[model samples]
Target chain A: MRQFFGWLSLVVLMVFLVIGALFIMRPFGEPPSVMDDYIIDNAQEEAASNNVVAAVLFDYRGFDTLGEATVLFAAVTGALLVLRASHKKEET
Target chain B: MSKIVRTVANQLILFVVIFGLYVIIQGHVTPGGGFQGGAIIASGAVLLIVASGSQEIKTWLRERRLSVVESSGALLFILLAFAGIGTVFFFNFLVGSRLFGGIPSVGPNPGDVWTGGVIPLMNLGVGLKVMAGLSAVVLALALFSGGEELEE
Candidate 1:
């Protein structure tokens, strides 16, 4: 049937895509870009932290972290608001 | 739901809390950070809730208290970020100072506790915020659902 061939072709295309992605994958423990080198070299001196990852997250990218916190707060606020509104309506 | 689960959870909660605190405190030097540690801590609370039921522990898991904790944590983090406004938004102000100012040797060594100026404090603040937020949300959802599966 046409539907059967359609699903079969879809599966074949996905398999090819997966194989291609695997072939092009970057090697483990080796960075693909230049930014990793710079962050590693300067993290301790710039942020005074031994953990380069933490240094980058907290100091170099503090704005991103701040925005993340804001988003979380907003989510919690929204959840409470929706839940409370329903609870009030039920009470009435 | 059972005696064994409640007993095990009661005993393990302390260790989970301690580990989470350790991760948060040593975040500047360790691989773990505020968000990871906070999730770990909140997981402990969730284990307790799952075993004991939220309704039973409703007194301790007060929504108002959790909201206050989350708000205070947010305030603390924002204040800490603003503290560095003298130079920049998130400057490492404690660097090179006598307090929390110890610098580490370059390249791959065991990190110290006293280093990482505002990072550790920020970790604590963010950790508190996340822990309170997640646990509060879970508790509220559980309470809303009446803490059980209902018949349709």
Candidate 2:
């Protein structure tokens, strides 16, 4: 079941990525994005950060960054738990 | 593995650590951000583990401390994110205020260190979390393999 789900997820990711590439991948050099323009123009004034990328990650798109952080935290917790559980099983 | 390798690692570790810190601390004003900086720092830790055997490292680098630091970093990042709840989930409230805040002129120029408000703080939390989490993984694998070898 686990292996099946893992493969299924990979397939899903590939499917989405392929679909996204076909429809959403912007052209090289000249892309269609007003959001990028806004971030670059007003990031320093609004977020007061010199690095526009940093401002975008931490301020403009913070929820996404938070989710990424949460994912890493959960991964570490799961790894430690599994390692400890295996050690306990050995002891018992 | 040998004396020469160990000596080289010992000398290079300090420089790696300092560079990582610079990346993390100046993330808001520099090219490198939290994740990049954290990975760099973790590389240094991995180098140390490789230079010295995991058994010897276990004496100085406690698993409990790594767990604590990792948890704290995650907590700090979340806490900082939540603190801007008044306006939004991650609002930059300290733009004009005096708490690690300094508004810079709009557009390209040399950036200020005491600016970027919560960004620098978030970078710090993320850097710590990544450093601890990665180091913990390497340490755990090393320790577990060491145990297996002993059992054999």
Candidate 3:
């Protein structure tokens, strides 16, 4: 039956997804030590903020932060507009 | 499944709210900051709305002047940031000598309430924004879920 084949395909796809996730998470080897030290030493001054995480998020990688804020703003705006439209439809 | 669980949950929500505020106040010296603390505090408001009726919550929100509080917080933040720029960009604006020597103009003492340059102000701005936005979301959801007839 068509339903049986559809269910079979879904199961196959789920299995492949699980396998892909496992492969990506598997650790291959140890990372370099120098990289860690470099990050720790230069984190504060380069970021120019007291909060280290804020520094990383807003200063060290400002472009990424801008993108993130834009995305969030867009999402919130979309949600608000959608809800407003629904309310208007209901009233009419 | 009984009255006891409901009481306990209510008590837990209160404790979480107080702890969240503690985190917000001690943010500069501790791991948590304004965002985490504000979110947690907002959760307390959410708990009240969920546990209590929406009409009661709406009455409380309007009576408390929360919107005005939020607006003032935002305005203060912008003014503080402007002060930094007015001094000079990246010139230790917050803690530098005065131009006319009328007052030392040295920034607040380190670790003082007024310290941290614009950080505290920014935190306040973030807090207000989060509080207001969450309030709006919760109110909207409450209205929608109550199934009240819409007024044009």
Which candidate achieves the best DockQ against the true structure? 2
> Local error of candidate 1 at B97, Å?
1.4
lDDT of 2 at B56: 73
Error of 2 at A34 (Å): 2.8
Write one digit per residue (lDDT tens) for candidate 1, span A1-92.
Answer: 99999999999999999999999988888768888888888888888998877888888899999999999999988887777677678678
What would the per-residue lDDT of candidate 1 be over residues B62-150, giving only the tens digit for each residue?
A: 86798899999999988988999999998778876688867888877877888998899999999999999888888777776533432
Ranking by TM-score: 2, 1, 3
- Per-candidate DockQ versus the true complex? 0.48, 0.56, 0.06
Candidate 2 vs 3: which has more DockQ: 2
TM-score for model 2? 0.82
Candidate 2 docking band: medium
Give me candidate 3's TM-score against the actual structure: 0.55
Give the distance in Å from residue B71's predicted Cα in candidate 1 to where it truly belongs: 1.2
Between candidates 1 and 3, which one is better according to DockQ? 1
